[model samples]
Target chain A: MDIHEYQAKELFTEAGIPVPPGEVATTADEAEDIARRLGGRVVVKAQVHAGGRGKAGGVKLADSPEAAREYASAILGMEIKELIVKKVLVTPVEDIVSEAYVGVLIDRANQAPLFMVSPEGGVDIEQVAETNPDAIRKQSVDPRYGLLPHQAYALADFLYDDPKLVRQATKIVGQLYDAFTKNSCSLAEINPLIVTPQGEVKAIDAKVSIDENAFYRLPRVEAYRDLDAEPESESRAREAELSYVKLDGNVGCCVNGAGLAMATMDLVKYYGGEPANFLDIGGSSNPDKVVAALQIITADPSVKAILFNIFGGITRCDDVANGIVEATRRIDIKTPIVIRLTGTNEAEALEILGEAGFSAHTSMDEVVQKAVQIAAQA
Target chain B: MSVFIDQSTRVVVQGITGRDGSFHTHQMVAYGTQVVAGVTPGKGGQTFEAGNGARIPVFNTVEAAVRETGANASAIYVPPPFAASAIMEAADAGVALIVGITEGVPVQDMMTASALVQDKGVRLLGPNCPGLISPGKSKVGIIPGEITIPGPVGVVSRSGTLTYEAVNQLTQAGIGQTTCVGIGGDPIIGTDFIDCLEAFAADGETEAVVIIGEIGGTDEQDAARWVKDNLNVPVVGFIAGQTAPPGRTMGHAGAIISGSEGTADEKIRTFKESGIAVAERPVDIRDLVKEGLGL
Candidate 1:
C-alpha cells in the first residue's frame, strides 16, 4: 500500500526525523494559505502514488503564496502514471548544501530489512547501483534485534564527512528505521536528506510502502490507505475477496490460483489475443465470488470475452459451474464466456453447465484458443 | 525413493478442526497417507472420523501430538496470523519436515519462522504452499492424489494449480513422478528450487527434475546457477507470467516484476544458459520432461 508524500512525512516527523514543515492541500486556495503560513516560499509537490513526478511536471517551486496557488492549480488534477493528483503537499523550501539518499526496504534475497544509503541523492537508486556501485552502501539489519546505533552510524558515515552532520544523519537514519519497522513497511525512503548551509541535516522528501499482509497487525498504518486513489473495480474486487488487476486487453480471465491465472493470461496472448485483466477467485469456489468476479470483468466495456480456467483442488468445479449458471440469471452478461473445468467433481460440473445450455472445455489450450477467437470476432 | 515424504512418513495435521484442515486431512487420509494425529489446540482428546470409519486422535499441541503419536512429519492448515507460530511450534516439537498450507502469512513472520526452523534443523516446505506428494506413497497437503503416479521424474514448483497442470499433463503422457513439491508462492519460502533439486538428485528414483518458476525475485536465476554447479540430473524448466506487466503483481504477492529483475524472459534465458530445457508453454512440460529422461 503506497502512501502519499505528506503522509510519509507525517510518519517521519512522528518518528523524530527532521522534515521540512509541510501541509497537504486539496485546493489551490488551501495551497496558498499553507504557503502563506510557511513564510511564502514553498515547494508544491503533487501527492500521487507514482515516481518521476518532477519530470512529469507535477512538482514546482513557488516563490510567493500566489505562485503556490498557480502551481497547485496546475498539478492538482494532472495525471502522473495513470494516477490523478487529488492533492498537493506544500512544504517550506530548504537551503541545502548537499543531498544524499537513505532508505530501508525488505531485501527479498536476504530475507531481511536492508538499509541502503548513498552520498548521491534525488535520482533513481537502481541507476546509481548500476552505474557507480561503490557509491551505494547496503546493510541488512536483523529484525529481532532491530537496527543498532553502530549500524545506523556506519550508514551515516558513508553519506557524510563532517562529524556534526554525521551525528544528525545517524539520528535521522535511526528514526527512519524505527518508522520502517513500526509501520511494517516494505519500503521506507527519504531521498535528498539535505545538508543546509548552516550544517543541519533533514529529510526533504519521503516515501513509504506498507506490506499488505502486515495490515492485520498495523491498524493505524492500514487506515492510511487512500481508497480514492485506487480504481473502482480494484476496490470492488478487494471487497469481494478476489485478486484482480485491470489491464488493457479484450479477454477477461478468471482462474483458481495465482500462477495458473497468470499462465492463463499468457495463454490468451499466446493465441494472439490480449488479456483484459488478471483475476484469481482464490482457492474456495464460493458462487458469489464468481458472480462478483464476472460482474467486475463485464463492467469493463473493453472485455469482449470472459474465460474461466479452473483446475479445482480445494475449489469445487461444480460450485463454479453453478456460479456461471446463477450469474447468467441474475446479471445480463453480453460477453461470451469460455470455461475449462477439470478436477474435483468435474463430471458433475460439466453436467451442470450442459443442462444450463452452456458448453465447457476440459483443456486449457483449447479453451484459451476458443476464447481468443471469440474475442477477436466480437 | 521419494525426496521428502514416503510410505514410512507419519503425519500430523495442524488445525485439524478448521475447515481447510479437516477437508485436506480427509483427502490425505483417503490417499493412504499415515495421518497419525491432529492438533486443534482446544479440541484435544477428540477423534476426527475421516468418513471411512477411520478415527484419528486430535491433540491440543503439536508437541503433545508428536509425543503421543510419534509423528515424524506435520502438515499445517492454520490461518495466516497463526501460521508462523505453528511452524515454530512444529520445529520446537522436533518434527523433521513441516509443510505449511496456510496462505497470507506475513513476510516478517515467515522470516522469523524460517530462521527458527533452520536452527532446529527441520525442513519446512511452505507457508502458503500446496504441499508435496510422494506419488502412491504419501500425500502431505492439498495436491490431489489421483493426478500423480509413482515414477522416475521429480517436480518442484512455486505454484499450486500450475504444478498440478504439469503433473496432470505428465501423467497423461505416461510419465509419473517420484515427488511433486510446491515450495509456495511467497517471497520467502522454507524449501527453494535448489533445496528440492538437491534432494531430487539424491533420490535414486528421480532420474530427472522439472522446475516451475514465475516472475519474482532472483530465486530462479539462483536455482539455475545452482543446477549448473551442483547437480547431474537433467532439468526441464518453465517460467510463468511471460505476458505479465511490469510493477503489477500477477495474482501472487511475489509475482510482481520489480526493476529489471525476475522476468520470465530473464529466467528462461538463465535456464537455457545453464543447460536446462525451457518450456514455452505449460502443455510442453511433459515433452520436455520426457526428453530430459531420454524416454
Candidate 2:
C-alpha cells in the first residue's frame, strides 16, 4: 500500500530520522497558510499515489505564500496518471550541498531486507541502474540480526566521503531500517538524502509502502488507506470477498483463482477481445460470493459480455452456479453472460445452469472464444 | 518413485480442529494418505474421526504431535497472522517437509521463518499454496487427489486452481503425473521453482515436467537457467498474465509485473531460449506436454 510522501515522513520522524517539517493541506488557502507559517519559500507537492510527480507538473517551487496558493490551486484536482490530486504537501525549501539515494526493500531471492545506497540521488533509480550500475551499493540485512552497525557504516560509505557526513548517513541508515521493519513496510526509500554545508544529513524525500498482509497487526497503519485513490467497484469488491481491477475493455471476466483469472483475461485478449475487468471470485466460493462477483462485473458499463471460468478445487461449481442463478434474479444485467465450469461437482453445476436457462461449456478455449465472439457482435 | 509424498509418508495436519484443517484432513484420508496425527493447541487428547475409520490423534503442539505420531511431514492450515510461527514450529519439531497451506502470511514473517527453515535444512513449500499430491499414493495439502493419476509427468506451479486446471486437462487427456507440487504465489515463499525442479530431476519416474509461472520476480528466469544447466528431460512451460497491466497485483500478491522485469514476454523468451516449449494458453498445456514426452 502506497502512502503519501508526507505520511512517510511522519513514520521517519517517529523513527528519529531528521526530516523537514511538512503539513498536508486540502485547500489552496490552507497551502498558503502552511507556507507562510513554515517560511516564505516552500515546495507544494501534489499528494497522490503516483510516481514522477515533478515530471507530471504536480510539484512546484513557490517563492512566496501567494505563489504557494497559486501552485496548490493548479495542482489540486489535477490528474496525474489518472489519479486526482486531492491533497498537497507544503514544506519549507531547504539548502542542499549534495544529493544521494538510500533505500531498503524486501529482496525475494535473498529472502531478506536489502539496503541500497547510491552516490547519486533525486533522479530515476531505475534509469541510474541501467546507465551506471556501479553507483549503487547493495547489502542484504538478515531479518534475524537486522542492519548491523558495521553493515550500516559500510552502506553509508557509498553516499559520502566526509567523516561527519558519513557518520550522520550511517545513523539515518539505521533509523530507516527501523522504520521499515517496525512498520512492516515492503519498501522504504529516502531520495536525495541531502547534506547541508553544516555537515548535517537528513531525508528530504520519503517513500514507504506497507505490506497489507501485516494489516492484521497494524490497525493504525491500515487507517492510512486512501479510499479516494481506488475505484468504488474495487472497494465494494473487497467487501464482497472479491479481487477486482477495472480495465478498458468489453468482456467482463470472473474466475476462481488469481492465476486462472489472469489466464482468462489473457485468453480473452488472445481471442481478439479486450477484458473489461480482472475479477477473482477467490477460493472457497459460495453462491453468495458468486452473486456478488456477477453484480460487480455487470455494474461496469463498458462490459459488453460477461464470462465465468471456474476450475473448482476447494470451490464447488454447483455453489457458483447457484450464485449466478441467484444474481440474475437480483440484477437486471443486459450484457451477454458466458460460463465455463469444470472440476469438483461439475455434473451438478451443469444441471443447475441448464435448468436456470444458462448454457455452460467445459472447455476453457471454447468458452473464451464464444465470449469474445459475443462481445464483438455486441 | 514419487519425489515428495508417497504411501509411506506419515502426515500431520496442523490446526486440524479448525474449519479448513478439518475439511481437508478428511479429504486427505479419503484419498488413502496416512494422516497419523493432528495438532490443535487446546484440542490435545482428542481424537479426530478421519475417514476410513482411522482415529487420528490430536495433540496440543507440533512437538508433541511429532513425538507421538512420528509424523514426517506437516500440512499447515493455521490463519495467516500465526502461520509463519506455525512453519517455524513444524521445523523446530524436526519435520522433514513443511507445507504451509495458509495464505496471506506477512512477508516479514516469512523472511525469518524461511531463513530459519533453510538453516535447519528443512524444506518449506508454501505459505499460500495448495500442497503436493503424488496421485494414487499419498495426498498432502489442499490439492484435490481425484484430479491426479500416478504416471510419468511431474508438475510445479505458482498457483492453486491454475495448477489444477492444467493437471485436470492432462489427466483427462490420458496423461498422469509422478507428483504435482504447488510452490505457491507469495513473494517470499519457502520453496521456488528450482527446488522442485531439482527434486523432479533426481526422481527416475518423472519423464517430463510442466512449469506454470506468472508475472513477478525473475525466479522463472533462474529456473530456466537451472533447467538448461542441470536437467536433460523435456520441460513444457506456461506463463499467465500476458494481458495483465504493470504495477497492478492480480489477486496473488506476487503476480504483478513491476517495471520491465517479471513480464510474461521475458519469462516466455527465457523458456524458449532454454529449449522449453511455451504454452500460449492454459488449454494448450496438455498438447505441449504430449509433444515434449513424445506421446
Candidate 3:
C-alpha cells in the first residue's frame, strides 16, 4: 500500500499542505518539459517504492532542463532495492533555511496515531531517535478528537523558534493529520519540512502508506496502488485471495494459516532447505485457490519442490486434497509436492490424495523433511 | 478452573447467519458450549438448529440478544468490514468477554473499537482470533474441540493453527491444557499475552503456561517482562517465522519484521533472559511444556 512520493505530495496538496510544485514524468522529454515549466533548478527523484533513493543514485539535482532530462534518463531504468524506476518526480528546488521532520503513524504499542516531530530532519527518524533521543518530541492523537490546534502547535513549537514558522508548521501538521486519517494511512510523513529563506515552511519529501485493510473504505487511496511496482506473483496472489510472499529458496510452501505458514517455512529451513515462497491458502480452502497458489509458486523457476501443510480448522482437509488433485489435473506441475494434511476429515482427504496417485502424510516434521530432501536433491 | 470460560459461559454469537458464524456455532454447540443466542441483522427471530437439535433464538442486535438470553459472552464471526462495529455492539450490550473471529479489520477501526471496549471495561479477544477453549468444559470460536483435553497447562498464542499445533503435540505427549487462548495476530489486538498470562497466573487450574508468538511487534518482549516481574508459574515460549525475511509479512498482517525489532531471534533472547524455556521448533513445544511443568 506504499504510494510514490509524488502521489503523497498530491495528497498533501489536496489537504492544503504546502509542497514544492512537482510533476511525475515517465520519459526524459516529460521531465525536461516539467523542468521548463517550473523555470528553476529541479530535483529529479526516482518514483519507486523504496527508501535511500538518493544514496542509490536515483535522485539528482539538475541545474537546467537539459540536466533534468539527463538525470531522468539515467534514473528511469535504474534499479533501487530490486525495484526498477519507471517514473521520476520533477520538482523545483526550494531555497531552504533549515530542515525538520514531521510524521504521523499508528503507534502499535500505544494503539493510537502518534505524531513525531523533530528539529533534525533529512535522515532516518529512527536513527535520530536512537542517537539524539531528546531531539524527537512525540504526541499521541486520539483518533476521535484528532490532532487539536494546541497539540499541533506544541509539535510545531518543538521544531521551530520563529512565531511565523511555528504557525505555518502547525497548519501543515494539521493538514498532514487530516490527510493521514482521511486516507486511512498507516504512515504519513513529511521528511525534511523545509523552511525557506523567506520563512515559508513546506513539505519537500512525502511518504504515505495506506493500510491495506482500509482499501474497502478508501477507494481513491486503493486506486493509488501502483501494480507495476509490485511483483506479478504478488498481485496475482492477491487477486486469487491468497496471502503470498515470494522468497529466494527452492521449496515452495502452501499452508492454511499465517502462523502455521511461517512455522512451515521455518521448518523447511530447519531441515537444511530454503523456502521459495510463503503461501497461505487461508482458512477457507477452495480448489481454485489451491490451483492459483500452485500456479503462482511454480511460476517461480527456482521452485524445485512444493509443500502443503494444512492443519484444517475451518479449512477442510478434503477440500485442500481436492484442490491439489484438481490443480494437478488442470496445470502441468513439474515440481514434486509433499503434503501434510490433518484434522477435519483428514482420513477422507488422504483417501482422495491416494486415489489421485499422490501420497500424503499426517506428520508435519516428516513431510517438511521429505520436501526439504527432495528440494535439496533437485 | 479455567482463566476465562467454563461451562457457565452463556455465549451469544454475532453474525450467526453467516457462513463462518454458523459453522463454528455448530462446532461450539457440539463441543458442549452453552450457545444461548445468535444475532443476525435482518434474520432475527429465526431459530438456528444446533447439533443436538436444540433451537437457538436469533436476535437483530446484540443488546436484544443479551437482554433475551442473558448472554454474558459473545463470539463474533462478522466480516472484516463490520467486525469493529460488531465488537462495539457486543461491548455496548455489556458482554463481559467479546471474541472476534473476523480477520482483515481495518487497524483504524480496531483502534476505535478497542477504545470503546476499554471504556466499557470489557475484555475483547481477537478481531482476527480463534477465540479460547476451556478444554472439556466450553469451546468458543473455531479451535477444534477434539485436539484439546482438560489438564493443568494454560496456552496463550497470537496464532491459530500454530496454537493448534502446540496443543496437538501436548495432547500427543499426554499433557492436557486448562484453557487455550488465541490473542490474535493483529498488531492492535484487544487482549494480549500479558492479559492472558496474568489470568493464568491467578487461575489455580493452570500450573504452567505455553506461549506461541510470531515475528511482529514487541508483545512478546512485553509479555516476557511481565512474566519476570510477576507470575510464579513456569512458562515455555516458541516464536514462528525464524527464517522469515525482513519487511515481508509472513501471513498475518501483524507478522512482519519491522526494522531491527519484532524478530524471532530477539523474542527468543528475551524469553531466555526472562527464564522462559524457548522451543526451537513447534514440535518441541510439548517437551518444553513438560520441562516447565517438571513432568
Candidate 4:
C-alpha cells in the first residue's frame, strides 16, 4: 500500500499541498527533456519504494540538464533496498532554511485521528519519539469536528519561525489531514517539509500507506500494491484467501489464526528454531486451505521443517489433520512435520495424525523443540 | 457470567445468504447459539436453519433485522471490500457488539469504521479473524463448534489458530475457557489485547485471562499497562513476535506496529513487569494461565 515519492507528491498536489514542481522520467533522455523543460537546476531522485534513497546515492543535484540526464541514467536500474529504480523524480531544487516532519494516524486509545508534527525532519521520527518525546507534538483530532484551524496553527508554530510561515504550515497540515481522511491512508507523511529561504513551506517528500480495507474508495492507491514486493508464498496465500507472511527462518508454520501463528512462531524461536513463515488457514479448516498452506510452505527451499499447530474450534481438529494428510498425499513434502492439535474432535485428529507417522502434541514447547531440532539437523 | 456472548444472547448473521455465511451460521446454531436472524442484501424473506430445523428469518439490512428480531450482537461474514461498510451498518443499527470475520480489508476502511463504531459505543471484534466464542453457550463466530469444553480461562489472541492452539492445550490440560476471542491479524483491526482483556477482566466466569499478542504493535504493552492498573483477575500474556526476525511483518495486516518500540522483547518485558505471567512458548501458555488462576 506504499507508493513511490513521485506518486505521493502527485497526491499531495491534488490535495492542494505545495510541492516543488517535479516530473518523473524512466530514461536518461526523458530526464534531460524534463530537466530542460523545468529550465533550472534540478534534483534527480531515484524512484523506489524505500526510505534512505538519499543516503543510498539514489539522489543527485544537477546544475545542468546534461548532468540531470547523467544522474538519471546511473540511477535508472540501480537497486536500492531490493527495489529497482524504475523512475527518477526530477524537481526544481529549492534553497531550504529549515526542515520539519508531519504525519497523521489513528490513535486507538483515544479513538481519534492523531496528527504528529516534529521540528526534526528527514530522519527516523520513531527514534525521536522514543528518545525525545517532547520534540514531537501530537494532537488527537475528533473525527466529527476534523482538525481545526487552531490545532493546525499550534503544530505549525512548533516548526515555523515567521508568522507567515505559520499560515503556510497550517495550510499544509490541513491538506495532509484531508489526504489522510479522504484517501483512507493509514499513514501519510511529509518528511523534510522544507521552509524555503523565501519563507514558503513545501513538502519535498511523501510517504503514504493506504489502508487496504478502504481500497473501495481509492482505486489509485490500491493499484500501487506491488505483488513483487510480497513473498511468493504470500501472493499464493492471497489467491487462496488464506493469510501468509514469509519470515527468514527454517520452520514452516501453519496455524489457524493470526495470534496463534505469532505464538507458534514465538514458540518455535523460544525452542531455538526460526519460523520460515506465518500462515493462517482461517476458520474453515477446509482440506484445501491445509493443502494450499502445505504447498506454499514446501515451495520455499529455506524451509527445513513444517509445524501444524491447530487449536480447532469451529474448524474441527480432525478436519485440519485430514487436510494435512490429504496435502501430504498431493505434494512431496520432505520436511519433517511437528504437529500440536487441540480442541474439537482432537481425539479423531490425533488418531488420523498418528496413522501418518506423526503423533499430535499437547505441548507447544515439545512440538517447537522437535520442529526446531529437526530443522537444524536438516 | 461469560464475557460478551452467553446462553441468553440473541445473535444475527450478516451476509448469511452466502456460502461461508450459511455454513458458519449453521455451525453456530448447532453449537447452541440463539441465531434469530440472517441478513443478505437481496435475499430477504427466506429462512435458513440448522440441521435440527431451527429456522431463522432473513432480512436484507442490519436495521431491519435489529427491528424485527431485537438481536443485540452480529457476526459478519461479508467479503473484504464490503466488510467495513457492513460493520458500520451494524454499528449504526445499534448492535452492542459486532464480530467481523472477513480478511484483507484495507486499513483506512477499518480506521474509519473503528472511529465510527467507537463513536457510537459499539465494540467490534475482528476483520480477519474467526470471531469470538463463549463455549457451551450462544456462540457468535467461526470458532470450531465442538473444540471448547467450557471452563474458567478467558482467552484472547491476535492470531486465529493460535487461540485454538492455546485453547486446545488448555483444554488438554483439563482447563476450559470462559470465553475465547480471536482478535484477527490485520494491522488495523477493530479489537486488540486491551479491548479483549477489559472484557475478560469484567466477566465473572473468567478467573484468569490468557492474552495472545504478536510482535508488531504496542497492543501488548497497552494491555500490560491496563492489567497493571485494572482488575484483580489473573492475566497471562504470550507475545508472538519473539523469534520473528526483526522487521518482518505478520499475516494479520495489523500484526506490524510501526517503530522500533514494537519488538516482542519490549512487549514481553512490559507484560513481565506488569506482574502478568509471560509465556514465550505456546505450549507453556496453559501453565501460565493456570498459574495466573492460582490453579
Candidate closest to the true structure, highest DockQ: 2
lDDT string, candidate 2, A1-378, tens digits: 888898899999999999999899999999999999998799999999889999999999999999999999999999999999999999989889989999999888899999988989998788889999999999999999999999999989878889888899899999999999999999999998998877789898999999999998889888888999988898889889788999999999999999899999999999999998999888866778888888888888888899999998889999899889998998888888999999989999999999999999999999999999999998
Shift of residue B73 alpha carbon in model 2, Å = 0.2
- Alpha-carbon error at A269 in model 1, in Å? 1.0
Provide the RMSD of all predictions against the true structure, rounded to 1 decimal: 1.2, 1.0, 1.1, 3.2
CAPRI-style docking class of model 4 based on DockQ:
medium
lDDT of 4 by residue, A324-363 (tens): 8999899988888889886678899999989987778966
Model 4: DockQ vs. true structure: 0.54
Native contact recovery (fnat) for each candidate is 0.70, 0.82, 0.80, 0.74
Model 3 iRMS = 0.9
Docking class of 1: medium
Clashing pairs in 1: none
**Candidate 3 deviant stretches above 4 angstroms:** none
lDDT of 4 by residue, B155-255 (tens): 88877666666777787788998888888777667777777778777777788888888777677788899999995888887787665555445666666
Q: Could you tell me the lDDT of residue A108 within candidate 3?
A: 90
Task: Please list the residue runs of candidate 2 whose C-alpha ends up more than 4 Å from where it truly belongs after superposition.
Answer: none
lDDT string for model 3 (A200-293, tens) is: 9999999998889989888887888898898899999999999999889999999999999999999899989999888889887889999999
The lDDT for every candidate, in the order shown, is: 0.92, 0.92, 0.92, 0.83
- A315, model 4: CA deviation in Å? 3.8
Q: In candidate 1 chain B, where is summed lDDT lowest over 10 consecutive residues?
A: B245-254
TM-score of each: 0.98, 0.99, 0.99, 0.89
